[model samples]
Target chain A: MEQDPRDLEKAQAYWRENIRYVAILLAVWFLVSFGAGILFVDVLNGVRIGGFKLGFWFAQQGSMLVFVVLIFIYVWLMNRLDRKYQYDE
Target chain B: MDPWSVQTWTYILVAITFTLYIGIAVWSKARSTRDFYVAGGGVSPWANGMATAADWMSAASFISMAGIISFAGYDGAVYLMGWTGGYVLLALLLAPYLRKFGKFTVPDFIGDRYYSKQARLVAVACALLVSFTYVAGQMRGVGIVFSRFLEVDITSGVLIGMAIVLFYAVLGGMKGITYTQVAQYCVLICAFMIPAIFISIQMTGNPIPQWGFGSTLSDGSGMYLLDKLDGLSQELGFSAYTEGSKSRVDVLAITLALMVGTAGLPHVIIRFFTVKRVRDARKSAGLALLLIAVLYTTAPAVAVFARTNMIETVSNRPYDSMPEWFGKWEATGLIDFTDRNGDGVIQYVQDPERNELRIDRDIMVLANPEIARLPNWLVALVAAGGLAAALSTAAGLLLVISASVSHDLIKKTLRPGISEKGELRAARLSAVVAVAVAGYFGIHPPGFVAAVVALAFGLAAASFFPAIILGIFHKRMNREGAVAGMVAGVATMIFYILKFKFGVFDGGQAAAAGLTGDWWFGISPEGFGAVAMLVNFAVALVVMRFTAPPPAAVQDLVEDIRIPGGAREAGPAPH
Candidate 1:
């Protein structure tokens, strides 16, 4: 069967939301990895939690955990968007 | 340390793992071109996750990364963050879309999206360059482990490893490779974690490695492990463990290059193709990162544990009183002890002239367990684990190289009318040749093996990242724009690497050695990929504006891939 041409607008909206979600998640990605992990590392290292320097923790451990979380969050967000947009497998 | 029984443990474990792998390979051997190419387009997210992790975490990271971290201190975070952070991009930006496109290789996506044979050919070249360079290093890693631990020569070790990897990959194709990789992941992760957990509990009284590195030492000193490490490091005239010697800009650039390059890697990207649905692709990317994080996070902790354990065991100690591991490493020529002060004591201070002990950075992981005096069987397990990591990575890369030759060049470009059975045979034959070439490099590696491997990431970042991103994101991107961008990006990258890494263009070796002052924006060759990627984007955008947009059919193809719902007939995407 042919695609419903009326669904074209829906496709556009889906693409727009996908782009927005990607942009937001990538910003978080940059903030954790490049920002906390690198740029503001020295400033944050001044603060400590338990035995860990905040910046050092972010660089070695915190950023990687955040990265893993970010992907799953994207997956959850995207899957929900697919449902709302009526896109299926 | 033993010549029998426990050393016999290494033999028994290695033999059993290999036999199990062979059994798995034969059981799952590919019967069709589809199975050989994309594993029949059937893989669960969890299983694919393990396979992706195993495919990417090579022996270099398994055996050498912790050692590099021990020496580089905070600067080592470049690798820790750079390597793992790429998954964020892959999962969010690349994997699902690529899976929706539903192709066997990266070049297939590039070729179809851009709708150009030239684009496809350029991609094939880039894929070969990246995969071959990567596989050579993995082959050497396998050889080194066998020679060091199992008392075999490097050639024999590489040949034996090659035969096993070739058996599975050639016969089973991606399907065989995927299942074998999952099993390898299980074996290697257990071997890695067993030692790490033991050492963590011993040192910090914490069972978890991530917590163990940060917690206070259990020695009644009441000081955090990191704080103590910093103090000890400073006492020995080295930089504090929490501080880095690299400029922040250099670190930032290097980390970005690695992250971008990791997303662009063909073998890692292709792992997404084996999964059934777009959502599975996304979920598996997340799962892969979780599995990999288990090692990436523990690596820095292992660095701390090993460095502290090593210094306490060796520094200022009598040479005659050194442990058996030290002597064993010395015989391997990895550790050198000289009495510069004529005191017969090991002086391992950071100061060059006064230092009497020289230890290679690659020895840290292998030696860490021995220094901790863990079980002999545990040490042997590390060797087996290293082999698994190296072999898994090598096999994955070989598949990419083989597919690029057979599917992209032979089947698509040169011989489109070839039958499915003929194409499958071609793929298997190409895999054999690829392994032999990679094996030859392992035995007599080029003098510049390390440099070439480092540049593989840079070249990948420069070329493929832009082409693929623009292909999916910018439907107006035509063949002229994509081809020109790829060429410009790769040329820029090659020029930078040659001038900075090899001193080829203007500065000879002398100038290259001290070329830190000559860096463009203070970025080293290792960090140059980010700059080249920017050049690619700029060139492509400018060229696309001046050139014609792609045909209606290709634009529709782009729209179809972006949506999740159906197969190829998505009408037209609103521009």
Candidate 2:
């Protein structure tokens, strides 16, 4: 069966917005983890919080906490995108 | 507590959990192939989340991860970040779309998306190889736990585990496994948390393990827990607890490899197919992360507590007056101490040449309650928790292997004329045979159980992750590109691992001579998967540029999956 032309346009628009949200969220994830956690760890290590170095905290505990939050954010954002496109179930 | 009472408690707790699983299996008997394969797509999001947690946290995570952290210091964060961070990729990029595609297995998605039987066959092969490697480790874990608790040999313990798994898995399939996994998750988390809370309270006067990780010690010494640990490590010639020892590049590679590999695992991906809607898939991934984070966050605390307690308990002490727990573990060969230099005192240090203690990493979680002198019931509960983690993962992996063989290979490719009943029988029969094979490997393991399991993640990362991602997000990728990419990726990983780990083609030398100066860019075999996954993406993109684009119907299928609406209930597709 052929989809209506109007529905196709809506689907394309939904896809575009979904990709935008994913790209942005993933960039934040990479920056917090691989960037702050590893590459720039020396610079961040000069700073300390509690018993942990700033970079070391990101590597061990901070990145994972951020990952969990990022997923929930994506879920919330995509739900909004789905409602905007009339595709939510 | 006497040894007799400990044994009694272990038996009673383990028996109760097993009976509960058997009861659930009988109650959830599958009536149709769809019910057997994907649990009729009726699972709630939260229940699926709990089941995924139980299935994902294998014995390695429950039993050995803390031990690794205790020893490896900051380098252990690779596992902490790698395993949990992958859920973000799953929730955001993969799970919902795969659920919308409404398939029973990963091979189904790859086959349908590529519009080629050969692509399906390749996916099935990869899925089977990865699952088999993984199930072997779970089975070995079951053996280890049983041998410790029941005082039985490893081989007998493995056989008993195989029988229990076979009874439930063949009878109820995915439906039984799902409900049983929910129960197992409860048992494992409670078992894990009780001891951690006890140790935290004892050490830092804090009940929350996460907070206790940063709080000062309760011993009238104003020192923070991490600070004390760092000081102890430095005194012992070890790296600081908060500083990593591995090269930065290798750590990055290993972390990326584990993240992508976790996202690509067939057993994990199949859990999303059992959910009712695309939104449930997304929600379940989030819930699974929350459930998993409960343990992941607590583990580092356990690591710190165990390391500090162990050092204070044994350091500068006379060997003849060591704690009872030390002697018990030493009898089992897991903990070995020698009074070298006739000093009559034990010395546990970082320098291997002078170290007088050798402890297997697997003993950390199991011995935590004993080391802290917790009550007898909690110790018994640890045994049951270890079994739950191992059995749930083993059953999940066995199901994936059976489905790939019966549904993907035999029915889809060789005999499309087969009836639904015939396919169901094939799946059950294959599961029994797979269990037997896994049992054999568990008895006579190839190498260190945990290291072998790590290779499974590497295999998945190199072979499946890139192909699956491109299929979902890149509409122009063709069959030739995916097939070639998968082959190259898998072949490269296998060659590198075999040369470094097993010495397959290296003139029959037993040592890992290839891992020295000859290593590729200083990347270990465990971290090479990230590089190979990159190679897969590059090959697929470059090859697709020269090949014909996938037909329009395939493109439409990809487009349909990307949306969250119109997901059909998972049922038997028309043959």
Candidate 3:
């Protein structure tokens, strides 16, 4: 279980990058789902798209689509971070 | 088609699927305790994703969720937001690290991180309580599908479900459950989508239910489907499909509770442990969310379609000339028509004082094919799909419960000398007993099936989510803080539910009335868990500040768990 100091430093750096990515992604999640979908729904509802109020669509359909996309983005971002820090496995 | 043919089709489809599940169990039979516990950590990402989706979407999501949405209208968005939002938390905050921790169970992680058997025992109790509460709803879902589709009594239906779950779950363990769940994800998604696609095409000329939600109606008019639904809802005295009815604050609280609660659930969290690499855990979570979004997105569309179909088909129609589906459901007491004014026609309006047609929300998904005049075989397929959804979740919950009992309680704590084979046998025995208990509750369902399931999410959120997150992210979190936080969190949640939901400790009958205006800040029992979780965090932080920090070794363990390299194969821990 002995670790090289360099590997430890790399792991720490990797952890830092991972947390940064998580923070950015989660902020987007909250803004889209909670902010747009609920808190500011009325303002968005005034702007209609086809059959749905923009806010209503976000609450029911749009936020979920965004969530799926966000996860993929995290996956792609994390893979790169892993390789950068030599923790790709 | 006649009832006999429908019953025959249902029997054949269910039998084929059951046999397939058992065949998978035999094929993937566990060789060692590792295989039994975590599938030997060999599942591919996409396959694990599908299994996780199947495991997560229970009977409640498959059978009752759309029905609830159809009735609740915009308020139902709470479910849409809460259930799926938690996956974001799971992927970003918890799943990968826990997988890297390489434990057999959630309790195992808690125990090692806190370096206390007591902390593990508290988690075991919480996990069992949450899993037991959830399994009841799945069992009831099985019974509902059985009684309606197979014409069997509910008790018999539950027993049959018990036998099937017991066989596979006991024999194959996690390996069997994982493969069968992947199969179940296919059966259920197909079953769910075919009827939804049919109805969407009929109503909006859109084969994709997701698009059909926003598309214009098929009628010569260019009015959108949602616009038409709002008009219908207003005409019937119900809230508009896109408009909120509950207070915005309550909606926010409930959605947040569900989101955090979903993230904390042990059974769902356990799915991540079966994947091969830490990277796969992260990728599998994303993939699982994508698969789940397929059903989650389609559900609202199905709700809209089914609601519109019900109104047009039955509203203002004479009882004597009602559609075949209406009469069929009425025979089972799921649909009731009473013309109090002696009028021959049924008035399916929103007027509670004068409405003649009463429909149970649970029937919406189960009867959607019949309501839309879809083929008989497809109706039978929905039955099989509902069974798959219920059985997959039921088996998953049973496994978690059995593991808690046999591994966490007996071998880890009581009989440390037990051999690996003896532990595996104990796990299987515990699973059988767990199935029997779940089956009994399914037969005599504790009141509030959906509400009870919601409470399970709340408990998970309040108790485990905080503890596990702190265990990983807050290295200073000690055994005293973790254990105390769980007890306080769970106690507050249970007390709130019992007081508000069951009237426990209340002096008067009026006080016992559930979901009343008297609720604290209008927060329903289902939404109170979010508040309790906050309380848990506050208490834990304060307690930890006063107590000594965890040992340096525990801190090192936390740091090791955070890295993505070197996921150890999860096996029975060395005593």
Candidate 2 global lDDT = 0.88
For each candidate in turn, the TM-score is 0.97, 0.97, 0.98
**lDDT tens string, model 2, B438-553?**
99999999865545565778888987899889998999988989988988888888887777777778663743454545668877777888988988888888999999999999
lDDT of 1 by residue, B344-463 (tens): 889989999888888998889988898999988898898889989999999999999999998999999999999877999999999999999999999999888767866899989999
lDDT by residue for model 3 over B440-505, one digit each (tens)?
899999767656766798899899999999998898999989888988999999888777766667
Task: List, in the given order, the native-contact fraction of each candidate.
Answer: 0.91, 0.71, 0.79
The TM-scores, chain A only, for the candidates as listed are 0.92, 0.97, 0.95
Candidate 2 matches the true fold with a TM-score of 0.97
- Residue A48 lDDT in candidate 2: 81
lDDT tens digits by residue: candidate 3, A32-66:
88899889988999999888889988999999999
DockQ scores of the candidates: 0.88, 0.77, 0.83
lDDT values of the candidates? 0.90, 0.88, 0.90
**Deviation in Å, model 1, residue B272 alpha carbon:** 0.5
Q: Among all windows of ten consecutive residues in candidate 1 chain B, which has the lowest summed lDDT?
A: B566-575
Pairs with steric clashes in candidate 1: none
Clashing pairs in 2: none
Q: What order do candidates take by TM-score, descending?
A: 3, 2, 1
CAPRI band for model 1 = high
